[model samples]
Target chain A: MLRLSNLHKRFGQVVALGGLSLHIPAGCIFGLLGPNGAGKTTTISIAVGLLAPDSGEVDLGHGGTPERAEVRRRIGVAPQAIALYDDLTARENLDFFARLYGLSGPQRRERADALLARVGLSDRADHRVKGFSGGMKRRLNLAAALLHDPPIVLLDEPTAGVDPQSRNAILEMARSLRDEGRTVVYTTHYMEEAQRLCDRVAIIDRGRVLAEGTVEQLVGTLGGSSVVTIQTDEGDTRIETADPVGELGRRLAAPGVRGVRVERPDLEAVFLHLTGRSLRD
Target chain B: MNAVLAIAIKDIRLLLRDRMGFFFSFFFPLLIAVFFGVVFRGGGGGGGAGSGIPVAVVDLDNTAESAAFAAKLIAASELEVTTGLSPTEAEEAVRIGRLRGSIVLLPGFGEARRRPFWGEPMSIELAVDPSRAALASMLEGVVTRHAFEGLSEMFADPAKMRGQVRESMDQMRRDGSLPRAMRPAFEMFFNALDSMLQTVQEDSAGEPGEAADPAQAAARAGGWQPVRVSTRAVSARPSGLPTNSFALTFPQGVIWGMMGCALGFAITLVMERTRGTLLRLRIAPLSRMQILAGKAVGCFMVTASVAATLMVIARVVFQVQPTSVIMLAAAIACSSACFVGIMMLLAAVSRTEAAGNGLGWGVLLLMAMIGGGMVPLEFMPGFIRTLSVVSPIRWSLLALEGGVFRGFSMAQMAAPCGVLLGIGGMSFAVGARLFRPD
Candidate 1:
């Protein structure tokens, strides 16, 4: 479990984090959905102790901060950027990261080989990262984060530039991590990814959490309205109401209304409702 | 298994794969050392302990004094003396680049041995290629120094001095060409010199073996002639120094090698930060200090490795030997530490790969120029040498030279090593303070 309390951070004229706080639960995929420049990276940086907040605390259970080596060993982070040595082979990269976590020589070799196979990269294990394709690199990046097999895994845009197959593989890996009772804090721009993969989703905007709940709870509570469309000879009529079935029934009584269709809101609707439909970038 | 060493090993592996980094860190430095070694070692032939500057001595004057002077030249550890060469042969050796230079002791060299006030000015023909003006000048000084050393020996032997003085007086008295009007002033000076010689001769009269008979020494003293020797060039071989080119150039090469290591590793550090590797490293179970120490240790190990490799190669290929292996190791350790600190500072200051590459080389090249890496300390101008005290490269080179050839005792070794350690400690301290993992 990880807790960030009243984290306030600044970068000169920009406020990256403003009294932001979050409590990620154990043994589940927790999705942090935020637009660009919405304090996502800053929060991750603080959680990993790479950047210290001006005034706040990042508590990684057991009465210790992530700044402590013992506490930090329990956490793992795969950055949004493909963090790997270009000149080093995939296996070498894994071996190096594994060793940094104090894995012995034999253990590191075994773990690196196993992770390379798990990521579907055993065939190209000895190939340098410089020649790797974007999808392969993304997979290798995920493998690196899993090398030490820490309890808490934070994946930031893990499948950002990967193909569909690689994306599915990464999503499956995240699911497996959750199944193993490991907390997964995942950040991504894909709404469907959060809706389908995450047990609890937090939609953040402007460095603050706008909404946080399960997919059904958020969609139902923050859905606002459902649309009832009636197709007629002239055109199609659209209506927004809490009870789409009754609205569609009344609209269908009209002679010009040939057929009626009722639509229910989904997670995307709830996301758009909470954080306005505007491009952050 | 330590995290720091793991990161250090990873960094070394990454640097080794980079072509530019590999060239600078190893090959380029070796090229520099070998290039300068061969160039400065021009015309030195093989012989005489294989350690001194090679030269041929044509001893034309067969007198005891000339023989004594020739013996002195051979005794010099600096000049690898070769005997039994004609003046023409010695001259040809220098012309063909088979020898550094030659010293031709002409016919009048025995008479030219300077006695009290009057004797030929010890003229000898020195043969060397004119283009090698620095070596020419160095040879000239060497000859002058040894000539004086021989003169001191001549002065110390009372029998030789008394014999030469008595012979000069007799020669003066027998010259009928001298005008009778000026004979008394000349005779009075000669008488005074003779009186002084007699008194000195009497003082050592009781020491049996210490004194040589004046007649035997004076008989061997060759006939006097005017102050001149007939030859195209003038030379006198010098004494008491070693001339192994590797001894000098290898240390300089190691300096360049260390710079390469610093720049190479510095750029690697910047690359790690920019490429997001630092992010992963930061999130690992390691402190920021651990990461930096990892980089410093990597650079230090690589720098020391480069130095040791070059020295070993010099020992193997060039037959150059260090005066003290322990001292050389100390030099390697101190210089490596110094540059590792420089690497840290370079990494900390450079935010991007481009900046790291450009700025790292820029700083090192500039340091090399001012620190006597581009030129030796002996050849550097006064101001540059004065300013070089601040350059870590200068101290590193000094420490290495002390170990390799200067035969520096521990007390002599302490200054450069101390400065290097101090510089290393301070640089690492400040660099760590300024370093940002991301």
Candidate 2:
């Protein structure tokens, strides 16, 4: 379990975290969703003790600020960048990180082997990181972080440059961690990843929490009775402040519209309606 | 303890695997050591023989005596004489450093034997080039002694002049065989002969008044009588053919290699910082100090191992054995610490690994050049040698050479070690202050 209250951070004149708050219960896959330049990374960084917030407090488990060592002992971090020695073998890399977590000798070897197997990289464990593909490196990076089997895992866009197969495998690993009663905090700009993986989601932008809820709950909060999407040859795609579904449905019926379906807002529609911008933007 | 060992092991492994780093840190020094060792080992007063020395011959008179004197000079081993070289050529050679000196034989130099002591006698002159000042004095003494010997031999040839001396002596003895009036004439002649014998004796004894009193003679010989330098080194300065330029340069090479290790790992630190590896590590609950300590310990271990290996090789292969085991260990430790500290400082300020590496190696090379690693300090000016005192290479060399050369007492060795330790402590403190987690 983790709780962040009224966290605030600033870099020179720019606010990175504007009194943002987050709560994560035990044994759940929690997603912190945002676009580029959002405070998702800053929040994650502060929680992990890499960056200290200008204001507010962080609590772990039973509602108290976690000691640095205690937090380190119980948490595994998969950084956004490749945190591996290119000259070292995948197994050696795993063994090194495992040693940092205080595992030694036989225990380190055993955990390194197991982690290699878990990541589907046992056959290539002895290969140097320099020879690995982007996806393979990403997998090895994840394996290294998980070598110590900590109680909590923080993954920062672990599948960013990975292949779809690798991404799916990583998603499965997150599910397995949750099932094992480990709290997972996943940060990414990919809405699909969050929608598919997170039990609960917090949408953040410009260092502030925009919304926090289940995916369905967030969509319902958009307050739209029905949603309609129309592809037209006309340049103007904007619908004026009238009943969008009514006007769109009338237009479809009058013209050569091929498909029409009334619907509740999807995550993309909800995201646009709430933020006044496209999800990709 | 285990953490330190792990970091150290990892660093050494990495260093060995890096081909460029390995060569710079080890092989380059080995090459330099071999080069300088061969060039500087003593033979005919440093830099070996056939190193091109100049001698000037000045003939004031065209007589046989002077010409014969010049011929003897040309015949002497180790003297290179130029017959056509004018006084200007001789002066220019000494001036521009082409010639070491010129020999001038004054007109009637042979007549100095026939003259009484009054004004300055007609003597051979030795003109020297001051640029090679150290060699000039030595050459002056050598050439002057040779000229005097030749002049003496020219006057002493008895077989060619025996008839003139014997005729005069026979006439004097016959006249002495007369009465009282003739006895007075014979006594005067005998007194004249007595004076000539005394002059010969004085000349043979080399300028009579110049001989020192017994006390003065004893004092003059005392300073250099026992010319032994007390050294603590296990082995003496090796006998036989002297070491070359490579051997002389080897210590510097070792210091340079150690510096390379520091520089290489400093780049690694900068890379970690720029790539957010450091930030991520910090988040994992490791304190900033632990991260820094890990890196420093790793680099130190690599440097120490390299130094120790170099020492072993120097001893077994090159016959270099440092006398004081404790001093050897201490010097290595101090140098390693200094190198680590320097790296930490470079890493702390650099925004990127490339920048750090460039700056670190640039500074290292500059230091090596000035510290007498590339060129001998003997070739450098006094001011340059004075400046080199601050270089880490200077201390490293002194400490290492002291171990093998046995050229220092504890009193002499203390300053070098002290300066090395001082440098290590200062750098370590500065580096520690600058080190930050992020």
**TM-score leader:** 1
Q: For each candidate, C-alpha RMSD in Å?
A: 11.7, 13.2
lDDT, candidate 1, B1-438, per-residue tens: 398999889988888888888998899989988987887674331121222555788888888877887888888766767788887877655643345678777776776674523444566767764434456656656666777652454544555666787788788889999999888988888788777756655665655664476433322232221223323432211122344666678888999899989888888888888888988888888877888889988898899999999999988998767777888899999999999889888988999989988888888888889887886543454567668889998888878876776555677678899999999889888888998776
How do the residues A93-182 of candidate 1 rate in per-residue lDDT, one tens digit apiece? 999899899999999999998888888999999999999989899999988988888899999989898899999999999999999999
Off by over 4 Å in 1: A245-263, A279-281, B43-243
Candidate 2 lDDT at B48 equals: 19
Give the TM-scores of the predictions, in the order they appear.
Answer: 0.75, 0.72
DockQ per candidate: 0.69, 0.31
The local lDDT score (0 to 100) that residue B104 gets in candidate 1 is 77
For model 1, what is the C-alpha lDDT against the true structure?
0.79
The lDDT, on a scale of 0 to 1, for candidate 2 is 0.68
* Location of the lowest summed lDDT over 10 successive residues in candidate 1 chain B: B218-227
lDDT of 2 by residue, B1-438 (tens): 455455555656667777887887777766665555554443211221322244667677667766887887777665667676666656544432234467777676655424413223446666652212345455555555565552432133222223444566577667645676676676677566555544543444453443445323222322211111111111223332233233344566678778878887887777767766566456554556777788888888888887788777776777664556566677677778778877787777667777787788788777777776565454455466668887877777767655444334555567777887778667767876876656
